[model samples]
Target: MKANRKLVAAAVGTAIAPVLVLLSPAGIASAHGYVNAPASRQAQCAQGTVSCGQIKYEPQSVEGPKGLHSCDGGNAQFAELNDNNKGWKATPVGSSVAFTWKFTARHRTSNYEYWIGNDKIATVDGGGQQPPETVTHNVDLKGHTGRQTVLAVWNIADTANAFYACIDLQVS
Candidate 1:
């Protein structure tokens, strides 16, 4: 009788072990980040500067697989960001611009890349270390002028994913 009770207890423990592991903090450490300054489309949406859909509530969650040049990180909920005709307000900037990023969950970072069309304008190395709540990068846009959509990517060090944002700018 006692042996049967012990066997049942062990079976229960085995069944619950996987659930505990999935609920652990270590198992759910995905990083969330987005560009705020220069007011990326997500930032503008979050701040109510522009009308948006579900992405306005979770601007920092525009994460997707790396090497993607998309503004919404290929997220269906954020697909509104890919619409260039949505009347997004462009920030006036100079030949050189400073972009500020805000992270809701900072993780070990790989690097940050800024792109204009097919051209990569700037890259800031992270050396695989965890970052602060906010980071700023100064990007040079000397050769490019007028309205441009700059795709910003935040590559994670330990993960195969990255966060993405797009800043609309009217360069003078």
Candidate 2:
């Protein structure tokens, strides 16, 4: 009888192990997304254009609560992205360019917004659908020139969160 009881306990542990791992922080961290084109700060880190910490491994995981304007996506683990002196490479772009996002986990999106400093230059309505593996938007940089940093926000439709990506650019 005791042997049967021990066997039952072991079976239960084995059954729940997968569920526990899925619900862990590491699991959720693996499901978020970030910008890849124009090569966002995190993306640059991931691509070795810049030296970074753990953010270099999970470039898509810089997600945070929505309505907040921050490059790190409010995650301290990725805080290095906010450092301007990290020698982040700026891609040369025209006045109008396509900014693309490579999503590892696509969520229902509310919108995509782009900013240079405090000015909002463009916004694209997301239509509340799961994005493709990659989404691209045409952003106008009309009066902007020289070295500039653009902040892109991917607002999630069903959650109080968003993903942020900062891209350095040399607009010509």
Using lDDT as the measure, the top candidate is 1
Model 1, span 37-133: residue lDDT tens: 9899999998999899988888899999999999989888889999998888999999999999999889899999999988999999999998899
**TM-scores for candidates 1 onward, in order:** 0.83, 0.88
State the TM-score for model 1. 0.83
- Model 2: which ten-residue window has the lowest total lDDT? 25-34
The pairs that clash in candidate 1 are: none
What's model 2's lDDT at 64?
A: 92
The runs of at least 3 residues in candidate 2 whose Cα sits more than 4 Å from the true structure, single-residue gaps closed, are 1-8, 11-29
| Candidate whose TM-score is highest | 2
Per residue, candidate 2 scores C-alpha lDDT tens digits across 1-172 of 9999999999999999999998888876576787888899999999998899999898998899987678998988888889999999999998987999998888999999999988999999999999999999999996999999999999999999999999999999
